[model samples]
Target: MIYVDPSGDDSGPGTVERPFATLQRARDAARPGTVVTLRAGTHRLTDTFLLTAAHSGTVYQAHGYGTPYQEKVVISGGREVTGWTPSGDGTHRADAPGPAPRQLYADGLRVERAALSLDGHTLRRTAGGYTVEGTGPQRWDGDVEFVYRGAYPWSEGRCRVASVSGDAHATTLTMADPAFAQATRLYHSVLTWEGPGAGESYGVDSPTSVENSPAFLTEGTFATAGPVIHYRPRGGEPPAGVAAPVLETLLHARGAHDLTFRGITFADATWLRPSTPQGFLHYHGNGYYDGGALETVTFAEGQGQVTVPGDHASMPGNLIFEDTSRTTLEGCRFVRLGAVALEFRGAGAGNTVRDSEITDIAGGGLVIGDGARDHRVENNHIHHIGLDYRGSPAVLVTGARDTVIAHNEVADVPHAGIVVYEGRGTKVLNNLVHDTMRVLADGGGIYVSGPQGDSHANGALIRGNVVRDTITPYNFGLYTDYGAAYVTVEANAVHRADAPVVLTVWPPLEHVTFLGNVWDADPGDPPGGVVLKDNTTVAGDAFDSDPRAVAITRAAGRRPARHRH
Candidate 1:
């Protein structure tokens, strides 16, 4: 057994009396079944911790920690920013370590990224960015930046200033060039957050157009001016000390089987990969592939403990286990990061993430699969996710098979509670999902989209889950949108929502089944075009209400489900 203590030394022999100071040291010294027992305390790392097949453990043997679940062994990516100088306008300035991170925290709460906008004046859209009218842009320090919510809910783009020239009527900001021109096409639209088109959007022809115009000064805003990060508190409270994330990822392991990460709390990372505002998560298919796979983008470590390959690109997540099997994360805590808490790449198989709590992040809690298989995500508590970025779901499982997502509690998010897309033989059972789609307008408590032209979700089962209180126009307790196919809904309970089940497909769905479910809703809740079977509900249609029934009557050869009028 190897020992690790936050207060220990690196040069020591890693004994319990003189434990290793860093996880990397312990990782380097690990062999198969090497129990790396961690001493109780915080472990703030300055670099990415990697483990490979050479350090792999046996299929069922525990290789990592032997600590109790109550032990607070925090793995943090943050360093407190001291010497905050007050300019006295209810704001403070501190030297930021360059290139700069997108999110910050104060006393364990998320601080908004700094944004500048006019009271009523809309920005003029430009190819590079929007132009700030009058004195608004003129007030910014030279190091100011502009970040916009992406056209898609799942994407965001940020750009540093190439130049900011102020005229009497306007200040035009020419954005610095990005590493990949693909990014230019990725975030062309500035999404409207609320109002006329709450979720509607239009391309930004002028860099200054107000698409999703963020009303000025409601939340905390921040920006870096050269070496300084200027911050405005949310409600007149200056931060005791600014907390900036110094690491991009907590742990990165690929094709390393039989590993276990237990009883550890991972926190405070400033995930930035790719470069600029569009991290590794840009549009696939030449920047227009509907936001799922993040495979093509190459990532390299950069200055801010982030990895942005070119001059621009940034994407981050807490943990990445790719091309591996039989891995497990049990009794762990993941908090306060800019991207997904844990991500498993395409080759990710037979991995399990259970008995964990993930919260306070700008991105999703767990983003698993992209054609991966047999991943089990169960018995976890996920909430307050996508706090900064609303496009991410609590759990996004794409094209993963034999995956078991059960007994998890997901809440307080802007998008779907749990999204299963293009997966075959997947099970989403007995989970509790609520308070989601808070910022987004169209989504589901448990959403299933895709099985696009290229893929199909065959033999998928969504059974025994509880969904509630998802407010939005197209939001439902269970939604199968776009082109989801071959899905089954059985024995589920959907309550307190505007709609219980929705089928808003484009070309329509196929081989879908709904059986023995409980939907407690008001009158006319299901919204029509539903074919229920052997089920119960407070209101709405039954068996004949199923859209598949319409499909059966429409054509002889198993026609597609019809749309609701």
Candidate 2:
């Protein structure tokens, strides 16, 4: 076992007494089957360190000794700094004559000098003294005094504080006040108290605003309600012509079979960027062929921590897989993203995702096939997804076979909860789908569509799923179109929705079965090329207008035995 410390001596043997100075040196000296241990401290990394495919059976361990909490290592690419010059106006002046400017700290929020008044509390050379409603003002004889929570950007020795009114109430501040031309705006960093109640600490992106200025004031009431609080800028329009940043993915294999990463955190704080591009982390054919097998990778965020700017839309398509096999991801969280969370495109098989949380996404949550097959998605908690366009399914499976979807909780999406398109021999069972299609039209809990041309989707089993609280301008709970054939829907519970099921067949479906399903809403008249057998409904009447030439038997007050075909 060779111990390496990047900050320690390089002249001695690579042991605890005298460690290797650089990680590159330790990696170079290590052969296959070598366990290289990193010292228990922060190792600041710069540039990409490539562990090539040659070093097989080598485990590069970081912070492996001592208590796990005490062993800390941060691998970062360092910080990027940009220079700024003060305008030397009345609000900005050189307080100290030195190479580095004198630093000042403040408590209130930061705004422009033009928004300040004689009775207002500003950070401009103030030896603080005032009386608000007989309460003596707190005195701060410093060069810079903060009125509210301050804004800390990546600049050096400069911050802005919010202004206070004569009554000791904080005023709404703006970034358009000429003092913030080249400034970075940190949103909603204020602490407020109403009367004798406990103070509330607002997060950075509270008080939603839609102004064009960089800093929009937040919305909050004083001890007594004042003007409507709305002066902040909502982050929507991409900063002029600056396109979103592109995320670069680097994958390396070190002769290890079964490389997996689970419960990792990836977040972006800047606006005008998509956080990440579509398919940020992807693996296709290289890692496995080079004596490595990547399996069971999970990427999720921590609880209650908002990863992106609250005003912007959700991020998109964080993970994509192609030709990888037997992977599973569950109990994860995604927010403020654009496209799908986990997507498998091209010839992958046997993946499963369940019991996870996905929300605030513009696109769908899980899409299981462009060419993949035999996937199972079960028991997931999916909500607040599909905010972008219409027709986005929370779980969409296309061009896949023998897939099983069961026991999941899905809601608040813009499209259908589960959609099986161009897939054969798939089963959707015992799931609860509700509150879908929030924005656009064409909503449904489950939609099954067939493939075009010579490819036919045959033999699907849809059973025992509960559909509720679905609302849209158009559509139904279960819809089939084109050449979909041999589908079985049985013993399902649907409640409080318009248009429960609509089956449309253009090319004449073959051997369709609807059995023992209970519908609380009006079960619409079935179309042609469908069969209904012994289906029980609470609304006594069989069908509004039967379009299919099949037997419809209703057995009420009698318990029906479970039947399987």
Candidate 3:
């Protein structure tokens, strides 16, 4: 067992008596199964500590030795070494002014080369020294030693050059020929110069050119590269792949038998970058092939943003479980996403998602199926989604089997609340769907459609669901077509200002059952036949001789039965 303080004096024996000064020293001294405990405090590092196969079983734990709240540990990157105070003088001197400060400059800091981590202290720049203010005996701030130096083109002109070297380094800016600064004022710009070595300059309207070129006022001559780029004055959009900087995802698993995360919160400002292909978390195609138990993790994106590209069919913040088995997600939340929240794809089986909340999405919420089988979805809250396009449903299922959806609350979606297409043995029960079609051309609460030749969805049971406040140009609470068969609808509550439900079978339905349902609005005169037994319609007149339509006598509290027209 070796102790690495990262901030302690290096003169000791790397133990309690004389501790090692850096994390890398402890990592180098440890054996294969060693546990390195990092004392709680900000331990700034100059580089990213990449763990390879050799460090597989190595446990790097950060624990507080003193007050729990006061202990913190942080690793950082890309810091520049300033002047250090001598032991006798007890005063510091400037070391070549380090990197140029940004528009806002605060000093008295520790600089490193690569990634940095801060623990148990607030990191804020100050005039004298970087303030690591909090509380605890284990609190300290120091930078790990690493050096990375890269050069960019320096055109002789009046333009501000802003550059971020690597990770955990602040952006630095310098004005080229500061006297002529008025002729060129840079703002959120990047300039690329093709010379002996390709160099780049970044800032607002910064300039770069080929060779040791004196800076010239050349318009549209510089290009920049990185994760983020914002043009000023007119305030143009960021480049395609740019996103806010933040540590993205964290995972904890117990063993190879598949660890499960039931109720976890994943929150960050840059959870999903709008112009980039980054979500908070993604787990797809990492599990068993023969439907073995895979790792299951649920993310509640609390006040986070997720972006998906416009050209892709899938949405952002989506969790796709492909060819996995026995995974479930319940009681999660999603907001401001580009696509569906959860998608089961490519022969995935035995998955379930229930009692979750999805909102503010550019696309619809839940999409199960598309080569998935034997899934259950129940008791979810899906609302306020699908602003971009039409025909986005709250729940869409296609090519699935043995799926049961029940007791869900869906509202304020664009197209249909629930849609089932091309599958078998699906049971939808006791769901409350309302306020659908805020932005759709035509909408329905429930729509079931099948493929061209194949009969759509056999042995489906839709019962005891409530449909209300669906206002669309072509509205229907429930519509089934495209050679559907053997679907039973019973004991449902539907209320609409317009038409409530429409049962249209193009090739005609076979063996469909409708029974014991209460309709506030009628299906008109002569409701069709299958089995319309024990049904009560609020409409004044009943259908006459419709094969699928049944008449029922209304009682005070008993279940209605189908009556012959």
Candidate 4:
């Protein structure tokens, strides 16, 4: 066993009496089947911790993972910024010259970005810029961003601000080149019901809000002016600690096998690609379409709406595992991250992430990418995600084979809670999902789409889950969209959604069965090739009173003894 402690020296022997200072030192000294025990403290990382095939059969565990004396062990990817001085204004300033961070944590809580809402104002799109009524300032500090709600109910796009003109009550904010044009050319504003070819053409509406300007700097918000970062404390109280994320990834494993990580907190990592001039022109879930690679396709589903290219790029993760097989991560915490917390890429097999907590992220919580096989994600509590990018889901499984997503509690997301898009033998079982689609629409607490497998032997099963309180404007409790087929949804409970279940027929669903399910609303008659049998409908308030509903809710989500904190 190798030992690592924050207060130890690097030259010391990796023993309990004289532990090594850094994790890299311990990792380098380790052989196969070595257990690297990390002491209970924050281990800050300057660069990503890399693990290759040489690090196979290794276990990186916390000091007291299964003991009563277990304490917190944090792996941080943020650098401390000191010397805060007042800049004569209300905000405090500090010289934190580095890669621009998309997220900031003050006293271990997320501080909001400086923003101004233009919801009730008259803002018109212009040739060079937008002409807005009742503008606040003549000029602003830092790089500004226009946060737009376009693509109807699916996407939330952003564009960089180039320059501001005009004076006093009226302002013309010229958006930066290429990005603004790309955003406008991709994200459509009109719905499919508007006309026969309404959504075919590319268009974007006025921005719902503007972000990262000095004029928007207020209590509990922060902004940046070039290399200097500024923060205004809530109620004028000073922050005890502030973390500015520097590294995009904290851990990256490739071609490693037989690894385990237990009871470690990976925190404060940022992805800066979205903050660049390229901007985040969101498409669906965690994906965004690039304008340079323009390949538009038409989906016959739902009034023949146009779709972006299928090969869209997803938001990158802060912790990535690429082609790493037989890896397990348990009792870990992924928090305060700017992008996807963890991702499984390539054709990795037999990976598991269980008994973990993921929260306070700007993007998706977890993503099992295409080509992966036999992954298990269980008993995790994922909440308060999509904090910056509103279109990102809580958990997404795309094109993985024999993936099992079970016994997880997902909540407090702006978009879908759990999305399964194209996979074989995928089992989504005994999970509790709630309060999804709080901002964006056309998704659900549990959403499934695309073909499950080639035949019934490898078909998907979504069973014994409880989904409740899918917040309105629009959404469903359970949704099957965009050519979902060869799937069985059984023994699930759904309540308090815009609709109990929405099985789209425009794309012509095939061999999808809904059996022994309970909901507050009936979805009416089944379409061709779809079967709805042994399903019951109850009153909306019956979710609290009904014994079956209460039992299902109690049985779902994280198992009682498995929670880490």
Cα lDDT of model 4 by residue, 1-565, tens digit? 8989989889999998999989889888988999999998889987799999998988988988877877789999987767888655668888763666667788788889998887786767776557877655456658788887645577888888888777766888788867777776676433466544455545456678878876788988888766778888877766548879888999999999998999899998998876777888888889987666655445554444454654678998899999999999998899999899999999999999998999999999999999999999999999998999998999999989999999999999999999999888999999999989888878899989989987666888999999998995668899988889998999999999988888654567888999988899879888887899998888867667777777787789998545342
For model 2, the local distance difference test gives 0.44
How much is 86 displaced in model 1, in angstroms?
Answer: 3.3
Question: Which portions of model 1 miss their true places by more than 4 Å?
Answer: 58-70, 116-119, 131-133, 142-162, 175-201, 205-221, 232-241, 273-316, 452-458, 520-531, 539-565
What TM-score quantifies how close candidate 4 is to the native fold?
0.95
What's the ranking of the predictions by TM-score, best on top?
Answer: 4, 1, 2, 3
* Comparing 1 and 2 on lDDT, the stronger one: 1
Give the local distance difference test score of model 3. Answer: 0.44
**Candidate 2 per-residue lDDT over residues 1-565, each given as its tens digit:** 6776758765667887788876666667777667666765433333234454444345555443223342433232222111212232212122111111111111111111111112332322222212233212222112122121112110011122223334354223321211222121222122233343123222222211111111221221000001111111113211111111112211222222212222221211111121111101111100001112222211222111111122222222445555555554433344433446556666666766654556655456777775677787776677776443233467877778788887777888766778777667788887778887554444467777674213225478887777766776565766655466777877776655666676554454655667777674545566566777676555434332222211221211112222110
| Superposition TM-score, candidate 3 onto the true structure | 0.45
**Residue 277 CA error for candidate 1 (Å)?**
6.4
Better of 3 and 4 by TM-score: 4
Cα miss at 133, model 2 (Å)?
A: 50
Residue 355 displacement (Å), model 2: 3.0
Question: Which of 2 and 3 is ahead in TM-score?
Answer: 2
Per-model C-alpha lDDT, please? Answer: 0.64, 0.44, 0.44, 0.84
Tens digit of per-residue lDDT, candidate 1, span 30-97? 88877787878778888777778987882211224342333567888888877777665667778765
- In angstroms, give how far residue 378 of model 4 lies from its true place: 0.8
Off by over 4 Å in 2: 1-259, 265-316, 451-458, 505-510, 522-525, 539-565
Weakest 10 consecutive residues of candidate 4 by summed lDDT: 188-197
C-alpha TM-score for every candidate? 0.78, 0.48, 0.45, 0.95
